[model samples]
Target chain A: MTTDAAVELAGVTKRFGDVVALDRVDLRVPSGVIFGFLGPNGAGKTTTIRLLTGLARPTSGEVRVLGREVTSAGFEVSSRVGYLPDVPAFYEWMTGEEYLAFVASLFGLESSVAKKRAGVLLEAAGLAGVRTRIGGYSRGMKQRLGIAQALMNAPALLVLDEPTSALDPIGRKEVLDMIEALAGKATVFFSTHILSDAERVCDEVAILDRGRVVANASVDEIRSRAGRKVALEVAGDVERVERAVAAAAWCRGVTRVGARIEAAVSDPGSAQRDVPAIVAAAGAGLVRFETVEPTLEDVFVELVERAS
Target chain B: MRGFRPFFLKELREIARTWRIWVLPSIVVVFALTGPVLAKVMPEILRSMSSEQLGGAVISLPEPTWKDAYAQWVKNLTQIVTFALVIMLGGTVASEVRSGTAIMVLTKPVSRPAFVLAKAAANAVLVTATTLLGAAATWAVTLAVFGEAPLRPIVQPTAAWLAWALFLVAVMTLASVLVQSPSGAAGVGIGVYAAISIASLSRWAVEHTPAGLIGAPGALLAGDRPPLSWPLAATALIAAAALAGAAVLFARKEL
Candidate 1:
């Protein structure tokens, strides 16, 4: 792996019985970026996490993390990689402090070191002074503890699986904020179906659909892929205007549904020229014309729908 | 250390807050106290009932003995305590999956093998403690009621019980690894037990093969006359190890 690549998957394939959980897929996560793996459930998000963390091996592929092949993966990367499972499981008997200490022992840390580090992590994750048993912790508190455990070793790459799915609105915000705060300290590759969480924290994202990554790029690169769309609600003669707009070589795909005309244009500058001429020639009264930029949710939904 | 300590402690906490911990112990304790009392009084009670119906007819009944008291305790364990033990440990991994708790631990640096091993070790400790406590209580009560017959060396029986306890723990661990829900694990655990029991019953395997570990515990408890051999002891130990290994392998297996 290159110094810039915190995680790299080359032609990874995972099969579950007869079903293909992940197809021959490749993903790259550069250093110091919060990368989001956005897909609906069973879209290979968890499978990818399993493969990367060595929880499960890929049927055929290579996974490299922190400049090492994941062949001896388990605890090697565990120290450098913190993971928050989609719904983290914990020992309800432990207080937040005790739970962190248990995770620290996995790293072979001294008792004093583990306790000190766990104390810092608990406070950082905003779980300080919570003396209740984990059984009594709210879903949000559990998620916070999950984050704290994942980050306990001061890992280089933190992989979280749908960490915010169970949290309330405010809780979700806090978790996302915690992730964002760790941007420079660790590389986070978290999977989420919640687009807003990804939008809030992720600088990079991959859209997985049907066991393959349909779109993998920086947030801006994907936003740029679908280009821009101009929607027009003309008062009269929409078909004539759509036909006129369709005849323009610059307009890529044009569709007319009732009075609303939608066209995918490569350049908004060309639309500035064609829209007015068509409306004037067809004697159509332009009710509203608006340019809509694609959102991560829109791109994700469109990509998944098109791939399937 | 990894997921095991955290997960094990978590289970202990769950047992404390819920009614299950109290319920399981209370039931065991009740059986322990009642076994000897029931044995001594049952024959006379039945005789009195018969005399009342038959108008004071002379009736002879077999006197209850120390053997009967121990037999009653074994029967309770085989029929009821065993079921409860299976239920308690069956959900070790299942409840985590259902609650989305497994996701949190497995995604960490903790290997799936360690997770399964931790569970096996923890549940084994809990079950063994509970079983022995009940056994000890019953033994004490038997001494109090029967005035202590010549104490026989119990080395072999103690070993067998320990083996059985470990076997139960391994089986329950395997069950948890195979299913995503507690109910699913319990069903599969029963199915596994049934399969092993059926295998042990086949005359072809019992005479020529080392498969009797599955059946020997019950056979011995039921008063079957068989010499205790090293092969039988080894079979239990090996089976326990194999089941634990399988649990580790399956827990690490991808979902």
Candidate 2:
């Protein structure tokens, strides 16, 4: 295990009777970076998070957090890891302050230290001046409070399972902003099916498909390796422009979308050189021609499709 | 045992905020206060009705004593307080599991055994305290209403009843850990209680199992110096075993 790795799993397999939730999954999340576990629903993302948090034991192989075996060093390792489940529930009677203080007490923090930290975290989560009971808060407020409680101990690794999954757009943005601000403070390992959210804030991502890690790399690496997309708008004879682009050797695939031709190209330089000439020869007026940066969505779809 | 104090404190807080703290204790106290008053008023109530129902025939009977008052209190505890205990603690662990609250807390430094122990300890402390307060109230009322009853008679029976209460709470905690729903937990608890009560009808079971403890209080209040019975030992053993069993099962639970 690398010293800088915050979480490590080696050939970990978790089975519930005849069903295999995670199949021989291997992963390494380095410290001090935001790592995104991207997958569709029922893709075992939550199962993997449970294993890392020591809430569930793997059927086989080793699971480690902070370089310690999770099964044997459960509490010792858990002390350094903060986790938030998908739907976090709190005591409805507890106010935001009371709940955080309760969580801090579990971590054995002194009362004074816990009080100061709770104040800072509440402000960071935008829950300052909210003295109402948790049951009275909206979904967004509860989610924000969930984050504050998870950060009560200032854990070295914060594992959030779909923190923003059920939130509105505004709530999603609020949570994402809070996660983005924790970039250098802790290693965040959050799971999400929303590729755009991962792309917006995650430094590195691992895409899981049907209980296995299909793709794992830095966001930039995946984007660059997924190749580039080029779009062309032709003013005349759009069909002819599409046919020309489809027949071009440099283009991987081409399809006409509305009045434009979109193509996936492995070689951007060659496609840029060859596409315009082909369109012009086909007697079509080229209105717009530009290469588009590949998105995480594109990479995710391609990887999952290939794995299946 | 790590996180015992924090978890226990949280359980206590929950009991205080919710109706469990006041409702169960209030019920017990009300029953205790009414027991002696009911015992004292029975003859007067019957005499008034006898003139009309029996054509002016006077019904004669001996006056009620402190023993009768104590017996009335024990009867209420066995029937009413037992049900209250089961309902109050039925969802102690199951609700937390269903709501995903257990997941959040258990993922921290808290051990599963510590969580179970804290929950059991908190419920035990609450039930024991309230029962004792109710017993004290009964003793004071009986002494004022009836002339000069010794403290030993009331104290002995109250101790016996408290032991049985502790056993019931342990069983309820185990049931909560075993089942997934609050109602299911209560069903198991009440079922086990009924089964034990039925089993106690047999002479062999009365001498061997914890079932004998429930009736011990009533018998003691009637001035029967029943020798230190095997069921008393069995009750204490079963309570400890139930707590240990709960901790073990909770540790293996997936959530």
Candidate 3:
């Protein structure tokens, strides 16, 4: 484990009977940053989170959290790690405040400290003054309380699995904001298939696909490495323009939508020079021709497609 | 064990919030109150029915005693209380696991043994309280109706029943850990109870197995001092084994 890494997994292969959930998966989450585990559904993201949280053992390798081997350290290391499952379930009979207090006590916090911390976390989770039973909470409210409970110990590493998967846009924003607020205070390793959520808050991301990590880099690096997409809006037959652009060796893929043509280009410099001439040769009046920055979604799709 | 106190308190709070605290004790108390009243009235009701059937010919009946009252209480416990215990605790661990609540708490600093032990302790405490309250109520009612049921017979039998209840809880706990569904756990618990009851008919099991513990109370009420030490010790050992087994299995279980 690196000195700065909050979680590290080396050659971790978790298999259930005949199916492999995670195969030789290696990942490192640095301290004090939001590391997004980005993958589509069934891409081993939750499996990775479970391994890191010590809820399940690896079939064949080592997992370390907060510099302690999870398999060997047991609850000692668990004390330093806070985890929220994909669907966080609580005692529905308990009021939100009571549940949080109960969690605080599990961490062996003093009574006064537990009370103060519960109050602060409740406010931070946007659950302040909500004394209703958890059974009465909305999906979003339950998620927020889940986060609050996970933070009761002020843990070194916070693991959240799809925290925003089922929330509304407003609720997603609320959870994302809470995750963002943890920057520099605790290392937040959250898993999500939502590219926009990761793009908005993640400093680093690991793209997992088919039980393996396809890419692990900073968000900016993935965006840059995915290269630029060129958008050409023309006032002629879009099919003619698309063919002209697609024939070019530098253009990776092209999609035509009515009067506009969007082409992913590997060599942006050459494509920039050639696209205009191709549009002219095709007898199309070009309305707009510009290079657009690649989104995390594009990188994710490209990596997953290529890996598959 | 770490986090036992908080977890145990949480279990207690859950019982109270879910109304198990009141409902279970109320069931026990109702049975207790009805025992002595039924014992005092049954003979008179039988005599009246016999006289009516015999065309007003007088019929005499043996007077009811405190033993009858205690016996009624024991019967109610073995039937109603046992059934209630199985139903109430069948899902104790299975529901938590199925709902993913176990994952939430198990990821914290709490050890698996502590979690299992705390739940067992909370349930034991509740059952003990209910048993004592029911016994006290029965004692007062029996004294009023039967003119002084000796404390020793009532208290001893009640203690034996309490031990058996704890043993059943332990069985349910182990079954809950072993099975995925609450119904399955209940089935296993009831199966174990039935097996014990059936096995008690064996000649060797009469004096050797923990099955004898459940029958000790009735034997004591019948003025037969059944040897209780071996069966009680065996029940304690088996209950401890079940709880310990649950903890060990849960520790290795993948949440």
DockQ top scorer: 3
TM-scores, all models, native as reference = 0.81, 0.95, 0.96
* Higher-scoring candidate on TM-score, 1 or 2: 2
Local accuracy of candidate 2 as per-residue lDDT tens digits, A80-192 = 98888899899889999999999999999999999999999989888888889998999889899999998998999999999999999999999999999999999999999
lDDT of 3 by residue, B181-230 (tens): 99999998888989999988875675777888768888877778887777
- TM-scores of chain B, in order: 0.79, 0.95, 0.94
Q: Which fraction of the native contacts appears in each prediction?
A: 0.56, 0.85, 0.98
Off by over 4 Å in 2: B50-62, B144-150
Cα DockQ of the candidate 3 complex: 0.88
Candidate 3 docking class: high
Off by over 4 Å in 1: A1-3, A40-42, A92-98, A109-126, A131-139, A165-168, A230-249, A253-263, A273-294, A297-308, B1-20, B62-67, B92-100, B146-160, B171-226
Q: What is the C-alpha DockQ of each candidate? A: 0.39, 0.82, 0.88
> Which residue pairs clash within candidate 2?
none
In candidate 1, what are the lDDT values of residues A1-308, reduced to their tens digit? 36569999889888878999899898899988999999998799988887777767888888888767776655667668888777777767678987887777666678988888988888877888889989899899989999998887888999898989888999999899899999788899999999988887889999998799998899988877775888888988778888888888778888778888888888888897678878988998988888878888878877888887
Ranking by DockQ: 3, 2, 1
Error of 1 at A256 (Å): 8.6
Which runs in model 3 stand beyond 4 Å of their true positions?
B48-60
Q: Please, what are the lDDT tens digits per residue for candidate 2 over residues B4-46?
A: 9999999998988987778889998998898888888987889
